[model samples]
Target chain A: MDGHGGRERQLFELGRLVKAGLTQPLGLMRPGGVGRILAVRSGEGDVERGLLEMGFVEGACVEVLHHGFLGRDPLAVRINQAMTVALRRGEANAVLVGPLLNRATDVEPTTDQESRPS
Target chain B: MTAGTLAAEGFRPARIALVGPPNSGKTTLFNTLTGGRQKTANYPGVTVERKSGLLKTPGGHPVEVLDLPGSYSLRARSPDEAITRDVVLGRQARETLPDALVCVTDATNLGQHLRLLLELRQLGRPLILVLNMMDIAQKRGCQISTEALSRQLGIPVVTTVAMRKHGVRDLLGQIDALLNQAPAGDGVTAISDWVEPSPDAIRAHHREVERLLQEAVVREGAPEHLTRQLDRVLLHPVAGPLILLALLFLMFQAVFSWAEAPMDWIDGGMAGLQQWLSAHMEESLLKSLLVDGIVAGVGGVVIFLPQILILFLFILLLEDSGYMTRAAFLMDRLMSAVGLNGRAFIPLLSSFACAIPGIMAARTIAHPLDRLVTILIAPLMTCSARLPVYVLLIAAFVPATTVWGGIGLQGLVMFGLYATGIVGALAVAGVLRLTLLRGDRQPLLMELPSYKWPNPANVLLGLWERAKIFMRRIGTIILSVLVILWFLSTFPAAPEGATEPAIYYSFAGLIGRTLEPLLAPIGFNWQIAIALVPGLAAREVAVAALGTVYALSGDEGAVTEALTTTLAQSWTLATALSLLAWYVFAPQCLATLAAVRRETNSWRWAAFMFVYLMTLAYLAAFVTYRVALALGGG
Candidate 1:
């Protein structure tokens, strides 16, 4: 799972939208960046099992949707095109995602104007 | 395989289990298949719901169907999920091994659902895969080849829209086919090859699911654009919480406003029936039992049905609309700060209507400690039962004058009483979380289901189920308690010539006076003491008990008004305030205690709850009485 960390470090060294691996807290991500999951290591109990069951798996694409208003503790992340999982930053920290591909065409736009009916 | 062949072999109902991931439309399909002929109970000792229905085949053979609680895998983490695993593997002694399994999966999210299907397939049962919610999937432009999927998995596949009438017939036909063909192997023997799911095994299952989806399912446009658009507002940092609050406010307001006429209808109807019976029947124990005991006691409870239905309607809508998860997401931060899981929010909120269903709902929380704390604090919410008492006291004592831009003072006091209950629950949960039940906080990792309009038929079915449960409680526990209370208050017959009404000389009054010294510190007289005894059966019984006590004193000029006026003339302001404070902490409801005992699977926790709540009630009442006296309200 840490394989993505080294690759992410190289991208970070190149000084682009890339930062640390998805294993880092979701709070560390740029608000609109898109990434693919490398692993989900969120402890060993129902919590991790539930997260995995909800599609937090390797090779599935994920994008940080937004943070909650209070303390920004829980971060909403959209996985695949079918599910949105609301997770705490602490929980999201264990779910590893690869470095961002691009912001424009990858992540679903956070603004309602794009998805709203014209 | 025809019915005649089965009859020749001596037919028995084939037990088919409906298993699925949550939100996969399992219950809808079950309801459609069974057509409201379902029976629900608890799994013997545990509180996990057991729902089974008899489905009649087209040829008149019966198929017994059990709706197992939704689970992600055979690997069990929660008690609810454990029941599913045990029953499926035939490990439960009391449960019959299912002859076949109907593994339901979501048509929209086959990736996750297929993993569980694959896991169940290895159990070697005669399994039929159902791709439910086909209409929604097709609307989202996803195409699934059911035949190809069936061929790959070696099981019959059925496509269903669950909510529509015609969509379930194909699934029923498929079930018929599976049951007609005797299952391939003895299901119990296959357990030997079954491996417990491990983290690595799970990842492998996911890999296989991905590979399978690649060949069997195809998608067109954006899959969740509608969900995202709605969540952009419903889950907005500012707008989300605001909308949730508005919805809750509207719900409470509707509970009071919308149900007024129906409640009045029930009340008037019961009153007229009681009067006609009393006049027509001879003056005997049977008449008294029918009139005062059954009519007054149970009738008071039955009147609240309209409000209960309304409250449950809103709950059903919120659940069916798929916004419950979003509400959980919205409340996660606030709830975790007080040591509760976000999922506990709905159960605790439900407690505001009634604690029995609220505690039952707590089973959905996976973590044991969180579930325990949620159950412990649930009774602290001011249920609709408390409303009668609050309204009575507020109307009789607090002025009805408008204040703060036209809000009635009575309304303000009602709101204050509700706020006090919430504050008390939060304090107790925080204290318990820090002390006896202290543990690490569980992570909030919940799925937000795709939004959909609340299905009316599904909502109505859910409400009907709730109504049945409520009526069952009334028929059994509440009825028996009321009968016993009547005997205590009615017997030893009012000493033919005695002055102060019959109840004064009866067993109940004697017991009340005997217990008065213990209660006097809280400023309660023997009348209040008498009412408190039967209030143990249910908190709202206190109101009826007071009415009975007053009426027996020969002041029965229309029970409700007379009781209120008498209380105002007799009790001091300090006493009334103290009584309200006492009720705020009262562990008096026997039904809640019974539910707690059942849910926790121990008499010890139930006893612990009773003791702690009684002590709190006493202390709070004592302090309130003293403070009220000091403030010159005496």
Candidate 2:
């Protein structure tokens, strides 16, 4: 959805891990870092389905918002800005990701709003 | 399709069910629809709650609405989900199939919520898709084309902010029309034709929802702005835990300090009633029973209500504000280290208030092993019932002086007891996870709901319901048990006034004497033995039993004043500390045991819990007594 079509997709795939070496597990993303989910590295269980059912589908945007204190075991990831999911680093390891297509959030200073409900 | 046409036709659905994914605001919507009229009980043979309430449409047509447990799909995984599935599929014998289904979805998370809607659609019931939390979605600048989405799904859909308490006018009319038109939804019960969706089917459904989302929903603005900003600090590594600790410390301190005045009022009121009764009536058995048994016994238990409310107030606020999940997030590492799911934190924390609700809350934990482990250790969480016992013993034995600047020594002991409960639970959970019920740890996959100011109405309503439940327990169970206790201790009065209290010759006295030898190793006398017997009815009842026992023995003062002095004068410091240690591990509450039984769906687990807890209690008391005696406190 970066407004580029198959040509750009092909170019990115060609560069793959070299240019987009940032690709890693969602659990390893730094705070405020953005990533596009490629797939969940599922094993033998419903973890894959559970994550998918929670909207970790392909091409979904995810950002690591916060990490737990000790060893940063559990990380809170904002999925597509629609839902915030808290999963431990082990479970979050299932989510494979690469650099986001859109770098708007990085370029544009974040907007703030006083939306706190009383 | 208007409300008038449905009313004119006298067509009203007999029952309606609210179905949704977890955290879809389904319960809030149910509250909006049913108002304050609701009954919550267990489904047959399961721990899942069956909440039904009566609601009338704008056209004045009555409908029975059920608030089902939130589920991701009809293919049930947990007991809670099983109930939702069975009831919807007309497989639950105790519950008839809902006449029409109200499928609720969170508009903000339509990308995910719609997948469940798509699955529910396959069931072929008359469904009205409700997009709840529309206000939040709108605030986040999500543009959802309701008409297009409705047309695409071939179902009626409406947007609602259920928290607003509005009639959800669009939904009200839609329900009226759908129910009127599809009066025979019951006849569409074709359970066998529905096969459980494989993972591939789930993926296909997800694709379908993605397609629908692309076509009908447009996203804009900095998504989840407030939540992201708040989490930056609240979920920070160091400061987050410190804040959680501070909040918990403040909550416990408030439970003692804030409740003092109210507890005093109730104590004085009960004492006044007892005094008045004694002054007016003759010195007869009937008069004695009225004052000592009823007033003193019930007053001892009721005095702790303020403390219970204070504890629950903090819990309710944290729950409604959605910080509880974050706490679980932070605690997940430690929990998993001790072999528990992060979701166990909610139930375990609530266990400090009472174990019954804690055990019931475990149903939300999908893994049976995690849920069982959570339930088994729930009673060790120093519930509010134990507060009266701890407070009474501390006030009588421990100094009331402050430990540091404004930190009370007594409050420190109370905090220590709470800490002890948590440690005990964690240790036991570790051992259980390793020894019996060993399995792969449940993954941490909980939704961290957006931070919002807790809805005051919901918080207050929840507090009131708990308060009512507490008072009902006192009014019925404690009152009746005390009456029976009084009779047992009063009848067969000491023969020929053998120079001791009349209770010494009573049936209760004989039983206490018989059990004294068994408890003697732990420094428990006959009176403590007698109290421990009836205390099994409820932990708080032990406080009442102590009050009733000594008050009947003669010249013992009233509950709040007299029982403290009486126990202080008689029990050695070793015995007092030993008793406190006993309560910390004792599974004295029958209600908690019954809850564990029902939740585990077996007497075996309950019996195991009882045996382990009793063993721990006895060992704890023995060690405390010996150590205190060796230290010359005895």
Candidate 3:
């Protein structure tokens, strides 16, 4: 799948669909690719501050640490160090991200590939 | 020393900490258990404070009941929960480990409330489960078998209706029985195993608890009646906000209208007492000190007690009715847009009555940064203390011109001042979030409790507690500051040939004169400058200080009348507006500063807060003064 689009593919569309907790997306692996933080959506004012204070800022580095059962919200992420924080799916959905950097073999194939335009 | 060490020291009383979710009736339980016989004071050493009271067990032995901040679980999230965890685990430095734990859980919400119970059970303490709000549960057609729950949990279970004092005797009996049992030793059971266990383990525990609950609990549908009808209108998107605004307007009007008579009585009483003291006693400095220094100064602030009490009564009623959480929910969306979390609404709302408790209440927010941000901005909300100054200024200067039919111009101005504070807080929070505490927004996940009629007793007790605290401040801190201010405005008798009063030669006059240049940009005269010094103790103290300073500045016979007339004659509307603006943001209360220090546990943050707030106040006042002056007001 590497450069299969012959240099015409968008950088934002390169992440694999891995089964992980939706709520805690920060620690979930984007095996073989790096992702960019797109936006944060939260209903509460303080929660946004909390996410930012905890280093879940826009344009910050985030990597998946572990996945919980059935790809729910509890995903661990490595923002800077090996340290991880568990977030719920409701909270994780508020954080929008783009494609990850570099692909890994251990990652599952993207399930939403059909939805992505070539 | 660790809390465990403190517990081991053996000098401290055996501590019994009450932990529960908010709206679980923990405070009502605390009040019922302690009654008015107990001493209610802040926790020693730290500001993440606990309310401790004395409770006598059925066996007639005394036990210290420490009402810890209400929390949903043992998970150390907010400062309030952190305090509960530390105190329970014997980890907090200044607090001792609770010898016994009373977990108050609302019966109506058993599944959710049980999580905390389970967490507390794993702590291996001698824990007792108090099923609070049983009356509400019964009203909702909920049935709980206490015996079955006790058997399931292997702990004593007591049902209590704290508001009406129902089942309290039985609950006390259970506490006595537990206290007689041997204390648990040093082995602390790990709670992580329960929550982060293997999938099978988690499933098994869940199944077991479910089965236990199935057998022990029976609940019908929630009652649908007046509360639902009220909430329908109160929680409407448009009507809710309108009602809130209307309620607030009425509350302010009540604070002014209802308090006027008592205030007059207090004022008259103080004047008569002062006169009597001066007449009966021999002419001595001590006599002058007693009447002029103590009576005149403190009395001025004490007269405002009725207003403060009335304001607090409304707040307590609102809180007790369980409508506060709904208001928070309604406000969350608006607050989030302005960089404040929804949880900030309660604390800020509470600040309208007094910033001290409002700042203290910030512990409920789960995020530290969010709580700190709320605490830092709370003082800007224009507490009840500022009302007297605002009222005095408005009554003296602002013409009584109605805007629309039946809408008092004075009330409109009061509303405008409050709106200004709210706007200022939002602006500051937004700036701080963008520049300093820049971070992602946290999601607001708060439980909205079913509404209930506020227990009259609890409301009365809350009002009484606030009234007492206000009185104590007036008696001690305000009293002391007033005496000092009086002395400063007195002494240094005027020269024999001088036409001016003795106060002109006093230290306050000299100090005020020196401060004139610094305050001139804000259009404050020397007397106002002198008043601002004592105002640092409390915002309302400025009003009293003004009364005393002006009283001592001239003839005593017509002080109050002369002072009001002098203010009207000397001060312009722009000056009043500028001063009001200054107070809207000024970090004036020592109590609030002390609380911030206690909450943050760092002097750096406190100092930073002081400097930033003072700068804001000065700049705001200066701008207002200049703008008003350009408009030809002063």
Candidate 4:
């Protein structure tokens, strides 16, 4: 797909997931996004390869720690309790993710989403 | 792989490679095992640091330990990783295939490290798994069964703290046992057995690592939360940058303020020694050489050693405490705007002290373009070597009047010089990145390791290494240039009693007079021309050269004080300002060029650096001089 079309398709898929409890592209998640990676999409060179080697694979939990001070173009993320990796938002877009697992309750919410639990 | 095959070959030291992911205490373990007996070289054509050390086993068998660059897997991306993979697989022509591999795994982050170990295991080398940072893991309430881990992986497992003295004895003992068992100089499998791991193969390797961890490693819960809490504040968008700025300010302040006493002592000592030598030794070439040549020139550069150490102390501490990566994270956005990597921050910062270590430090930056761009721009930072020239010029010309908030004008101008360096570096990096280094978007998938108290031993070792490297430069490059400058200033017997001091008739004087016309537009006199020649050895040597030139020209009093006053009285304000501008943009040191050559593995880049910097220096000085002259300062 073309860039804009692919983005639209991802958003559509994210909407479908919100309705029917499934994974979505990580780029669709908001700033405080936290979820387990479904899969890392192919393309790009060192960034993709480095992410894979850093354990950003299927079933690995990822959390967007924070964004850059200015443009917020790059984001810091923690992967699988192993490491915190910083990447551009465009680079983070490759990792497809599922919904965040509710920690205390061990439940996956299927409906309305919140940025963080109070 | 049989032990019986190696027993007949006699006691050739067994070669062992220490491999691990970055920040996994691999280096600390290497230091612990090797003590102070480590040597660093480059891996053939690549600039990746090849570190090796000698160790004697309990059985008196000598072992050669090589610390390969920290890497995640054999699927190499960066030059560093490729060197590691090549060395491990015996594909490197200059390196021997290791008799054994010591896979250093961070106990706190085994899930990420075990994959590398599993991949190494497939190579069929004798492997000893080192569970480094075990103390941290235990403190976090994680339990690991070494026996079970060993049984599962079919390799000996050893736990090590790596920082404390006794922490690595068990590891050493285990390594000795493995060595004795393997016999001496047993050859490993051929490089042809290595396969390019497919995505599926890597995924399977990850799965196998997960399975191994599940069977042997246990924890009460998930990862520690302390780091996350700390990051909430330390990595905060606004607070993070502020803290970094504050830390940098504090570091610069310490470098200048704390080094004053020691600098004074060194100055006084050198002057006293020079005076005593002049009094005792009858007027001869040896006395002149000892006093003016050695003491004045080398002593000038050596006095800044304390300041260099102070700067490196902070850098080493930040690196050891795991905050360097977070600093990189904080810097990524700003760096990426200039088409550089976040990892380039530390090396560029190190350039403020000196460019050699800074260029060496650039090895940590993975991308060749980013690393080269960083190396090219590193010399642009206002290194401590330039501090002397800046201080001397500012003191001579810029006023000491205090401005807003009691900040002295001299201090403000010094800060401006440093700021100019930053601006120049940024501008050059922007242009170079656009034109020369243009390529794919430089990715920064940097791993910010967990924060820990900076280990004192590791910090000391790092500082010691820095100190040794600095002193080595002083002894070789600075010393040679100083001797040559002394000879240039002294030769031809002063034309047999020619008035206007001895140097006026010497070869150096002639060269200076000839160069004076080219430099005159920038307001530089023949003496300034003389200083600029030797100044190429090092930026600070300009101060020393100026001192020697004035002394040879029959100026009275101590070199520094007399030179400052003489410069203020003799040269136009335009000249001083122009010289300051020159130092700011010039490739102030030939050592920096040599470092650039070594790091980039090409004299072409070094030549390009020299030409570009010289051009920038000339243009900047011309502009500054013309503006100052036009403003009626001449």
Candidate 5:
């Protein structure tokens, strides 16, 4: 049940190469790109609560909604739905993520989907 | 615990608890209500102390005001909040429940602040609502009808601007009115009955409150245009972080730039006092005790007053102007990455002053693990005590060279030290989160208030309180430790005609010698080993201890020279650098460790904290020392 598309598979492979500590992947992550939750390096509690609270639970989707212009630390992430959260790059790297395929339609829909057309 | 036991023993006094959310001007109101008649001491049985002051109601009835920690609701997570919950519920073993509660809420931020009020209301305690910071609401073009709010809440509502001291008379009048209303011939209501309403119920309550607010309160317009404009710049995606960094940089710079003159003045004054005592008094043990013990030891700690004051000045101003939350929001991402909650920003920031209060401040962090982790790691954050040593080292050694165009090299080093603490704290938090206290990361939910002008009174009061606390420590803990160190250094009067300084013959010297081998791997010499003994009382005491040790080890000429020059001549650059690194992670503050023990109520956690910190300190020092030596800097 590999969920990644071909492009995502390529990015996942790339992420694997870069995944050493939290220092690599400098050139890979970009603002507005969707990413898959590859793995969570830290356990639950405040850190996990923080992640879940910010909507970064395991297997959930996330997108780099914004980036700082200068330092690579501060980042704004949009988790599943339209929930936007700001984080420092140091914090963002803790959540291991692989690139997502078909980022074009990743924009969160405004209305609840309970009654959406099938 | 003590209060309740004493009360049970028939020492009961009419008790009143001050309760409010963060940023509701609760502390300010507490200060006003209690004034100088207050005493701050440990709570009976629990290390979480209660601050109480005696006040007389307008009817001249005596009342004891207990300033409970600011808490948002009864769903307690942090120890401080738990204390509040326990005290209010009469659950604490040592303290009795308050006879009545004063629920303080921000007049302007009623929408969110009132949730706590609603929760407190459910506690069924006889409570009065104090609408604090009323002036701010008025300035923000918010008009709240006091009578209507009182009617809706079924509690007497009195408006107060705590900062300005306005509405105190009316508040006292209200308190008198409430006091006269006999307690319905029934005891205090049980807080457990206030199980927070279900989400749907809460939402309905909110809607009802909103409707009431619409009828009773009128907003002239949106908040002030200036506040919005300031927020636009302060909270900007691109600019917010930069501004925060710039503000922090300036704050550090100001600590050095502003405090230099005052610090020198204080140093000179101490030296003058020493000289006067030497000239006028006989060469008796008393004279030596006063001069060597009190002057040297206490003087060392007192010099840090300026730095502490300056640091707190920035904190107070930031808090007053309502930018502290914005700073937290800006840093949330970074904090989360390091396995810390964004709510930890305030507590971590508080550590710069002292870890005790900082640990206490962790009460605001909503997650138990987050709060615990924060309390454990807070001591590593380079508190004010370490500043004196840092300033001395940077002044004596690090060349005043500018990098990045115009930034002062000394200032940059200071900034680096601060960053090192932050980094180390994060690393520790990361490890702890992944290992011992693994759990889900708490969401970083925070309220960002509209920016406002920092009240001068609050800033001044904050500085005054910090200054007084620092001075008190100097007069008490540091002073006692210094005097003891002085005695240990001066006693068994150096063997007659000994070439070495008299101190080497004393107990301190023998102990230092014995400990030197253990510390040698980290570049600490015999003298530093000796200093470490007293350093446990407070980190900065090590600096003074070193000063006294070196002064005793040499002649008048040596005593006059700066401590750094002496170090530079005696030790290698690597040794000095390693010492700096060690201080960054040093488990030297007993008070902090004691605080951790008290907060966690577990000796195992306390021991773990000590071992972990000492290990990090040694490793950091070992690497730095060895690397520096390898670089041929010695």
Candidate 6:
């Protein structure tokens, strides 16, 4: 929080400051890393809505399961510990990931635990 | 409540619709419910499949069930989704609205499936919730309370394992109960007024769904270990592509080796029938038409059925095992390099079976230009219809020898022809992206469902469906085309004292001679010129037409000889090779152009497809003929 002014925190602090860029795009996360979805920005068409509809909402937990063979462009990400979706880096750019509020193991599916919105 | 309130006690509904998100096991449940008693039709004005079945309830009441296309939401983006949206809203022409809706959800992956369930609930129709695949969910140590789910949604809920036929009877009984409890006019609400929900509205809906899930479902996240373990190797960058190519190689090899016995039996049967007809009937036009035109023409195409069914069997198995999407994931990088994403790969792969459905499958691509480009190049996938023509040419021309360390030469030639089609498709796509239909690439986003074992019953049913479609094509279009060709070759007999065969003085010969000059440079004789005319109707008919044309040309008893042997003795190596090259890029069957027109909603693109393919065909044939002649192959 060096340059940032006093402001309320989001869901969880950037999931332990990642190496290679502080706040990374969901697409950039390597496999086995967990991050909290901070925001999903809109692109040309229904890019934003499509991401949100697929469970990439704010405060959701996401883990990268695997990356495609070539160029590692498309990544398979497990979201909310419930559904696994594959998306290209371009589409994953709409989802911004910050530090995980809790440890990766603490992440459970939305149905198993209740973390009601304030 | 409007008019049937007095009669609501025992009133029953007439029609019901089953709808759900893709991979929700919706189709499987439908298949189990209908038990092969379903019929497939096209929605009026569109090619989307309209599947309907008759379900007779235990109470002796007959209910018509319609299986709508799988969709994620009512906010439609593609033609498939649009059809689902239109029918549910009672706005589609020639489609009657169902009185009730049965929504299916995958119990194992209810996280996203429930969101779709929430969307369908907004329509205010008489709805029931089907929690399918409960067996796998239970295996993963999950518990879903159907009663609580029913209470939360104010709808009846049923759990089922549709795969092994468990809990289906209760679901059927539940449907019967719903029909009787509903009043005649109960479900007819203002469902037609639905519109696309805003992003904020959808987010709110998701929150509501999360709340509902917490109350009715309870379990720790049971990740699919099988999927994770398999993907480790299957998607292992290097091993992934190797396995994919190896699988493709095995498929092509099996198609050749496994089909020999069945093909021979069909061949022998055709020959015996021809001999019997010629021996019993007098030498007249009727006998000639039956033995020469009908039997020979239809027989040539029927021998390829074993090969076609083998090709479809591999496709069905891959799709069922959830490997198709993984293959698409592997293809994304190359596809994106050509201004397309991996989303277009599935349709292009499906094109290898037939281009009509492949073009129709392109609706999933949200970008209009990408969809158009995918549809245009789909015909280059070398569909099964072209197998007859390719096998005929190779059998007649190429020697039955091995190459490259024990690989069969004929199979190698067949493999080369398929490769040519693929290379031509990629080159055309690159050129189109550079010239026309240019647009920003839409990133691929697709669901990779959990891997499941391929159900044997489903695979068998799929194979049966494909076999029927192939036979129907021959019985209808191929038979009609041959009959016309026979009449043209028969009438206006040779003048007295003429030394040539009678067919030489007929209408078909005159027409073939007229077109011979244009095709002569490509090594196509007058006989091939005749076959090429009706070949436009269907690619397989080219082989059948050749069988008919040559049967009438040779001396008596020549019609009984196999077409393959007849062709081998008459055509040169250069001519055979040139024709194979022509087919690799030649114009597709007429139905393919019609499909392109319907999908693109314009004739300009269809005409463009015809012209470009014809140009490529002529150029390819010309070069092959010249090169083979120079190599001293004649």
Number of the top TM-score candidate: 1
TM-score of candidate 3 versus the correct structure, residues matched by position: 0.77
Highest DockQ: give the candidate number: 6
- Please give the distance, in angstroms, between residue A24's alpha carbon in candidate 2 and its true position after superposition: 2.3
- Candidate 3 per-residue lDDT, tens place, B1-634, comes to 3223333355454568889977688988988888876666555555565678876665664678888888765655677777777777777766656677899987765645665677688767788899887876777566788888999899999998887788888877876666556353434532323332222232234345556777787543243345434755775656777888798779878988998899888878888898888889999878878886777666756776787788778777887776776566566667777677777887887788777778877877877778878988888888877877887788777788987788989878887888888888889888888888887666565544556677787888777777776677667666676677667777576678966446666787778778889998898987788778767777876775676656543223355456667788889978988998888888887767866787788877788788988999899899999999999888
Q: What tens-digit string does per-residue lDDT give for candidate 4 at A57-95? A: 766777777787878756877776557777777777888
Q: Enumerate the candidates' DockQ scores in order.
A: 0.36, 0.35, 0.03, 0.32, 0.05, 0.37
Displacement of the residue B234 alpha carbon in candidate 5, Å: 0.3
Runs in model 6 with CA error above 4 Å?
A: A1-22, A103-105, A108-118, B1-13, B186-190, B341-343, B353-368, B395-411, B543-572, B594-606, B630-634
lDDT (tens digit, per residue) of candidate 6 on B346-460: 7887688678667877887767788888999999998877887887888888999998889999988988999999989988998898888776777577777778898887788
lDDT of 1 by residue, B1-634 (tens): 5432453355767788999988898988888888778888889889898999987777555788999999878887578998999888887658877878899888988878898998899887889999998888887666788877888888999999887855577877876776666653343532556667766567778888877776677543236677877988988899999999999999999999999999888888888888898789999999999988888778878887898899999998999999988889988888888899889989988888888889989998988999999999899898888877887777678877999899988888788888888888888889999999999888777777888899888899888878887888889889999999889889888876687667777888888889999999899999888888778788887887888777533212366677788889889988998999888878877788889999999998898888888888899899999999999989
lDDT per residue (tens digit) for residues B350-389 in model 2: 7877887778778888889999999999999988888778
Clashes of each: 1, 0, 32, 0, 24, 4
Q: What value does the lDDT take at residue B264 in candidate 3?
A: 82
Encode model 5's per-residue lDDT on A1-118: one tens digit a residue.
1234854775566566557433232124676566666544444334433443333544445655445444544565545432345565555666767544444433332222321111
Candidate 4 local lDDT, B265-379, one digit each (tens): 8877877787788889999998888887888777778788889899999999999887888888888888888888888999999988888899989988877898889999998
> Chain B alone, model 4: TM-score?
0.94
How much lDDT does candidate 5 score? 0.70
How far does residue A94 in candidate 1 sit from its true spot (Å)?
1.1
- Second chain TM-score per prediction? 0.95, 0.92, 0.86, 0.94, 0.86, 0.90
Residue pairs in clash, model 2: none
Tens digits of per-residue lDDT, candidate 5, B1-634, equal 3323333344555688899877788878888888767676766545555688987666665778898887766666456777888888878766766877888888865655676677778777778888898886676556778888788778888899897779988887776666566452255444455453443334444455555666567442123345545755776777988899899879877977898899888888888888899899999999989877787667766777787778778888998888887787777767777778767888898787677667866766767898889988998787888876787777777888998999999988887888899888998999999999998766454544556688775587567766665566556656666677777877778876887666667888888889899899988888888777778677877776777667643322244356768876787778888888998988887667766877777878888999998899999999999998899967
| Runs off by more than 4 Å, candidate 1 | A1-23, A43-46, A100-118, B1-8, B58-61, B184-193, B552-557
